[model samples]
Target: MPWWVEYGRSFFPVILAVFLLRSFLVEPFRIPSGSMIPTLHVGDFILVNKFTYGIRLPVIDKKVIDIGVPQRGDVVVFRYPPEPSTDYIKRVVGVPGDRIGYYDRVLYVNGEPVTERVKAQALREDGQEVLRVPEQLGEHRYQVQWVPQRSSRQGEVVVPPGTYFVLGDNRDNSKDSRYWGFVPDENLVGKAFFIWMSWDSQRFAVDWRRIGSAIP
Candidate 1:
């Protein structure tokens, strides 16, 4: 047998296993922005359950099976609609056919206000004070940040079928569905579930507290 053929035979199983695992089981991703602050942080390395929403062919992102649907407040990762090559992470604020409203930093779903409590505040390096607001979205609970005096886009939008409305935890700073419109169902990648590592980009140190944390 040729040397190349022998090498292919030896490595084929391992390569195929990895591909299947990543395409349908789990995949690793890194947080490149503060969109999911508090719940997720910049530089946080996360694991997304690829099969949670269904099995999608890798690279093409075409769902081949219907296993599950995205729910309100689920931390989800998807491809940016305008730029399919870019991946983004946000919390699902509105499911298909739901009326979602945002005004004065308060969120409403189907005309009912989603519960939000101001818990605390954190100061950013830029001297901005971000309020720690805990929100209850249906069955899920998570923390979101709001910068007082920071202008944000606010309005109501009815989530269309086969699409979802998502928002960043950093409410005032993120450009999410409010600005870009809905995320098509086909754009969904997976549900973000866990943080495997966290690196403080500014401090150049590991954020031990964020590591191994579960994403809400």
Candidate 2:
């Protein structure tokens, strides 16, 4: 075989394998915004389980295999409904056929208020008082941040079949389902499971404590 042909044959399989793994197995994503603050911080690099919610063909995002469905409270990454080419991460607040509501920083599912308890208080970068609270949605319990004094949008809507309602943990700052709309099942990319690394750009340092932290 020609030298060039031999080199191409040797590397093609390796490249193809990596493409399949990332497309159908797992993928890494960076948190680019503080929408999920108190849970997922900006600069946190997370690994998502691509197969957790079933396998889908890459690019097209059409599911070809059945595996699972996103549950309430599961942190997920999906193509932004309004802009399918962009990816956004948020916590699932309502699954198919559920009524979800957000009013005055409180969350309600199916007309029953989700349980939450204040955990701590801290000042935001803007010097606003923020409350850290543990909110329970189904079997998942995670902390969410709330700035009560900040004006926030709120409303109620019934999630249609094959769609999900999601919200960012940073209640007042996030532009999520409360703004754009529900995430279609086809738009789902995967469920975020781990924070493999974190970098603090402002301090120009690696946050050692956030490394290897599992996404709640």
Query: How far off is residue 178 in model 2, in Å?
Result: 0.6
Cα lDDT tens digits for candidate 1, 94-187 = 9999999998888899998784654555666367766888788877888788888788787999999999999998887789999999999998
Candidate 2: 10-residue stretch with minimal lDDT: 115-124
- In the predicted model 2, the residue pairs found to clash are none
Candidate 1 Cα deviation (angstroms), residue 70 = 0.2
Cα displacement (angstroms), candidate 1, residue 39, comes to 1.0
Give the per-residue Cα lDDT of candidate 2 at 170: 89
TM values, all candidates: 0.93, 0.93
Tell me the TM-score of model 2.
0.93
Error of 1 at 14 (Å): 1.0
lDDT of 2 by residue, 1-216 (tens): 899999999999999998999999999999999999999989999999999989888777678999999999999999998888899999999999998888877789999878465455666655778888778887788888888687878788999999999999988889999888889998899999999999999899999999999888
lDDT of 1: 0.88
Clashes of each: 0, 0
